[model samples]
Target: MADSADPSDTSKAGRAGERLAGAVKKAAGSVVGNDALRAEGELQSEKADATKEAQRAEAQAEQKREEAEAEARAEELRVERERLAAEDTRQEREERAEADRQTEAQRAEAETARKQESVSQATRAREQETRRDEVEAVRERGEAETRVRDEEARAEQARGAARTLEKVEEEQR
Candidate 1:
């Protein structure tokens, strides 16, 4: 893993050194009248330039590799985040569904309780009505018995008054 900075710095430095060496060789060749040495120096400079270009290419390739790795890492992080978010959403939905189920159960329980209460109320009402009917029937029977006794007493009193009137009439005669 190479640090992603200026990859051309080393190549530029190498190029500068090569240029300086070529210039010195050219100057020495003019002073000593040596063509072969000057030609050799030019070839050496070309070789140095080629080496610099190769280094520059290698550095560029390294930089591109680092960029690619960084991109891959970022993509991986993005995918992981998405996965976590989906998991959270799923959990939330599950929780909501559970809550809804609990609510429905509670509602059903409340309805059942209400129905039971209604049935109890109805039973109590029926019992109260039955008791009232029994009381009314007893009162009616007592009233009928009292009426019968009063009628018998009246008939006996009428008969006794008639007998006394008949005896008084006979004594007067």
Candidate 2:
């Protein structure tokens, strides 16, 4: 691949180099009848493969997180659109009611009371919808955070395993 500034690209190139070097070492060891050198080369190639797999898994997790966040934002926008539509409807009703009150002065008090009740109901409904959206957003954020933590834990485990293998190789040497 052509050189790029992306870290993933760098990592991919590095891993490829490691595998190539490992193959060379393994071949040289074989020619010299050296078991230790061959073993080390095998370990190096395996480590490179493991790191590549881990990076792939992490990229997948990050994609999933981005997708989830996008979904949440879309939902919030939909809710906001609905709320605005509702507000417009409420405003239209209020305007019509006001016009009626001006013509029917005898029923003005009752109309005002009814309008108050209608406004209260709309307010309560809006509050409930707002609360529900907030809860959903919080839940989505928590899930995304959990996924990130899990990925981190997996990466750490891979590192630990690599370190343990290195220690064993040292002991063998």
Candidate 3:
């Protein structure tokens, strides 16, 4: 099997070779007093440094982006919890209100039953009063009839006594 070279590794090796060549040129230019060759070598070195700094900055930016994403997820979870808590509070309020309504209904029913009981008691008392009045009237009528019969008997006895006295006076004359 043939080994395939990775493109990223090839690029990194190429950069390293260029840096070595630049260093050699800088040393040769310094020994030979060639100003242009020294300047070219310096330019190559600066380019490598600039490329490394740019890569570092890019890595830092990626890390910052990842941290921001994590923080956003945490905030989302906190908001979800708050929403659930609010829902729970609303349901509890509804349950309490329903319980209060049921209690009120029961109270009203009890009040109605009490009123009915009071009416029933009043009716029974009226019936009792009517029975008492009927019994009193019957007793009064019996007493009046007995008094009339006694008065008639006494009048008849008085008439008989008067007749007897007249007969006795005639016999004496």
Which candidate number would show the highest lDDT if scored against the true structure?
A: 2
**Stretches of candidate 1 exceeding 4 Å from the true structure:** 1-17, 30-33, 90-173
Give every collision pair in model 3: none
Deviation in angstroms for 113 in model 3? 71
Which lDDT tens digits does candidate 1 get at residues 3-42? 2254344433344455455555654564458997677667
Model 3 RMSD in angstroms: 63.7
Model 3 lDDT, full chain set = 0.56
Full ranking by TM-score: 3, 2, 1
Q: What is the TM-score of each candidate against the true structure?
A: 0.35, 0.41, 0.42
Instruction: Please write out the lDDT profile of model 2 over residues 98-155, one tens digit for every residue.
Output: 5544555544445556655765675676456546644654454466456656766898
Q: What is the C-alpha lDDT of each candidate?
A: 0.58, 0.61, 0.56
Please give the range of 10 consecutive residues that has the lowest summed lDDT in model 3: 1-10
Model 1 CA RMSD to the hidden true structure, in angstroms: 61.1
lDDT of candidate 1 at residue 110, scale 0 to 100: 75
- Clash number by candidate, in order: 0, 0, 0
**Candidate 2: misplaced stretches above 4 Å?**
1-12, 90-173
Q: What is the lDDT of candidate 1?
A: 0.58
